[model samples]
Each structure stands twice: as structure tokens, then as C-alpha cells.
Target: MNEAISLEAVSKVYGKGRGAVAALREVSVGLPEGGFTAIMGPSGSGKSTFLHCAAGLDRPSSGRVRLGGTDLAELSETKLTELRRERAGFVFQAFNLVSSLTVAQNITLPLRLAGKRADARRLAAIVERVGLTERTGHRPGQLSGGQQQRVAIARALIADPEVIFADEPTGALDTMTAREVLGLLRETVDALGQTIVMVTHDPVAASYADAVLFLADGRVVDTMTGPTAAGVADRMIRLGAWAK
Candidate 1:
């Protein structure tokens, strides 16, 4: 399979000299096209840093991040911004929605911001797929946490991006709500060919992924494939990843 996102020996450091701290060290990962992947690691194990650098939210201190065929290191700030906006989609624990906009408007916000016309059928279909068709007329504040996240997923999907980065999407959700959201995310990959890289600590959540990349310190220490929740937990434990 072709790579959608590839991090080549990437490294990120904060501060300088004696005061400097290494966030990621010689980290390399490949997210396959149309693949749903989970990245699991301890709190300070460079999971966020890796995602930020890989997503072009922050530049790596060294090495390269390739999204599709373009090398992010070669782009100017403006160009990088355009590339991120046009080619990437993000979903995080935070809603990051505009409170003033209706759900339909929020879902099509990216297209609107880029001065492109939103396709009515596509928008309507995606909203339905995410189970948000009934909530389209309402604003985020009028919805529950689960409903809000469904909108966020719909918004990310409306763009039809090459890669979707979801950073702990279920972190702020309750158990039942988390399962619903996660199931929808997995459904997107299976039914719509959506490529996703999700950062999560929960073994049950990671089980939904096609492949799980286990990170220790700043490096990929192991990988589990076609995993069940118990299988993933066993592998993570053996890799010395924190269980609780």
C-alpha cells in the first residue's frame, strides 16, 4: 500500500543546550493509505509531539514529515498552512467548533473557508453517515458531548482528506458515548476508505484500529496487528506500556 503519512527519522526538542529536552528521538512511522492506525504510549512518551510534527502543526527539530508526496520541510509557512488546510483533517478531544454556526454550517466550514462550494448531496450524506442528520439545525451548545463529537467527525469527513488525525477522540466521552464515537470512526475506514491515525491509551479503543503502533520513550517499540482488546492489552503490557 502507498503511504499517506510518513515520518522519516523525525526528532523534536524543546529549549536549547543544557535546558533542552528531547520530545522525540529518531522516530519513524508510516501510516498506510486507507488504514486505521492507533498510536499508544505513556503520557510524556512523545505521542502528541509526533502527531503535531506529523500533522504539520509544529515542525520537527530534525528530519522530514511527508504527507502524500510533498515534504513538509521544503514548504514555506504559508504553503504549509495551505497544505495542512487542503490535505489534512484533524479531530481532537476538544470540539474546536464555532458556537455561532449551525451544525450544517459547521460541517461545511472547511469548504466555506477555502472559498469552495460545498456539495449538497455529499454534505447531507456524510451528516447522515455520522448520525447527525437530525441535529443539523442545532448549534454545538444545543447538543450532548457525543452529538458534538459526531459533528466534529462529520466536519473532518466532509473535506475528504487524504489522512485524518484523531488525537484521543474518546478522551472526554463517557463509556457508551466513547464506543459509539469509536465505532463510527472505524466505520468510516471500513465503509468510506478513510485513512486515520488515532492517538489513544485505552486498549479497547486501540482494538478498533487495523494496526497499533506501540511507542516507548520516543521510539516505536512494538506493533500489534488485527488485535482484539485482550490481545492488544497483553502486547502493550509486554512492551511495558502502562495499563492504568
Candidate 2:
């Protein structure tokens, strides 16, 4: 399979000399196209830093990160911004929706920002796919957490990006709602052949992924395929993520 994202000897450091902190150390991984992968680790384990580098949201201090065939390190800031806007999509724990805009408007915000018109047929399909057709006319404040997330998902899908990077996407929802949202994410990978890389702390949430990359001490320590919630929790325990 083609790689949607690849990192080679990527490292990130926050400061200089004695005051420096290393977030990622010689991290290298390739996320396969059309695959769903979850990144998990103890707090302070560099999960967020890894995601930012892989998605071109931040530059690695050394080594290379490639989105498809484009080398992120080679891009100018303006070029990187354009690449991110055109090729990548993001979903955050916080549903970063405009408060006053209706769901449809919010979903089409990216297109608007890019000075491109939203294709009506494609917008309708994305909204229906996310099961938010009925809520498109409503503002974010009027929707439940799950519905708001669905809108976020719809917005991510609108651009048909090569990959979607989601950070703790279901962290704000209740169990049942989180399940629904996760199921929707799974369906997108299965049905639409979407590539998703998500960072989640919850084992149940990680179970939705095809594989889990476990990070500890700024490096990938292990990987588990066909992960289950119990199995993932056990692995975390072994990693000392739950140590008292």
C-alpha cells in the first residue's frame, strides 16, 4: 500500500542546551493509505508532537516528514500553509466551529477560506454521510455534542483530503455518544477508504483503529495489531502509564 504519511528519524526539541526538552526522538513510521491507525502513549510521551510533525502542523527539528511525495521540510511557510489547507484535514477534541454560522456554513468554511465555491452535490453527500442532513440548518449551540462532532467530520470530509489527523476526537462525549462517533469514523475508513491517524488515550477508542502505536519516553516502544480494549489497557499498564 502507498504511504499517506511517512517520518524518517524525526525529532523535536523545545529548547537549547541544559534547558532543552526532547518530545520525539528518532521517530520513524509510515501510515498506510486508506488505513486507520491510532497513536497512544502515557501523558508526556510525545503523541501530540508526533502528530504535529506528521501532519506538517509543526516542523521537526531534524529529519524528514513526507506527506505523500512532498517533503515538508522543503516547503516554504506559505507553501506549507497551502499544502496543509489543500491536502490535509484536522479534527480536534474541541469542535472548532464558528458559533454564529449554521452547520452548512461551518462545514463549508474551508472552501470559503480557499476562495473556492462549495459544490452543492458534494456538500449534500458529505452531510448525509455524516448523518447530519437534518441539522445543517441549525447552529452549533443547538446541536448535541455528537451532532456537533458529526458536523466537524462532515467539514473534514468536504475537502476530500488525502488524510485526516484527529486528536482525541471523542474525548468530550459520553460513552454512547463517543461510540456513535467512533463508529462513524470507522465507517469512513471502511466505506470511503479514508486514511485516519488519531491520538487517543482511551483503549476503547483505540480499538476502533486497525493498529495501535504505543509511545513511551519519546519513542515508539511497541505496536499492536487487532487491538482490543482490554489488551490495550494491559499494554499501557506494562508501559507504566498507570503506575501509582
Give the best candidate by TM-score.
Answer: 2
lDDT of 1 by residue, 6-112 (tens): 99999999999999988889988889999999998776778888889989999999999999899999999999888877788889998789999999999999988
lDDT at residue 95 of model 2 (Cα atoms): 93
Could you tell me which residue pairs clash in candidate 1?
none
Candidate 2: where is the Cα deviation over 4 Å?
241-244
lDDT of 2 by residue, 22-106 (tens): 9999999999999999999998999999999999999999999999999999999999988888898889999999999999999
TM-score of each: 0.96, 0.98
Q: How accurate locally, in lDDT, is each candidate?
A: 0.90, 0.94
Q: For model 2, give the 10-residue run with minimal summed lDDT.
A: 235-244
Candidate 2 residue 214 C-alpha distance from true site, Å: 0.5
The runs of at least 3 residues in candidate 1 whose Cα sits more than 4 Å from the true structure, single-residue gaps closed, are 240-244
Global Cα lDDT for candidate 2? 0.94
RMSD of each predicted structure: 1.7, 1.2
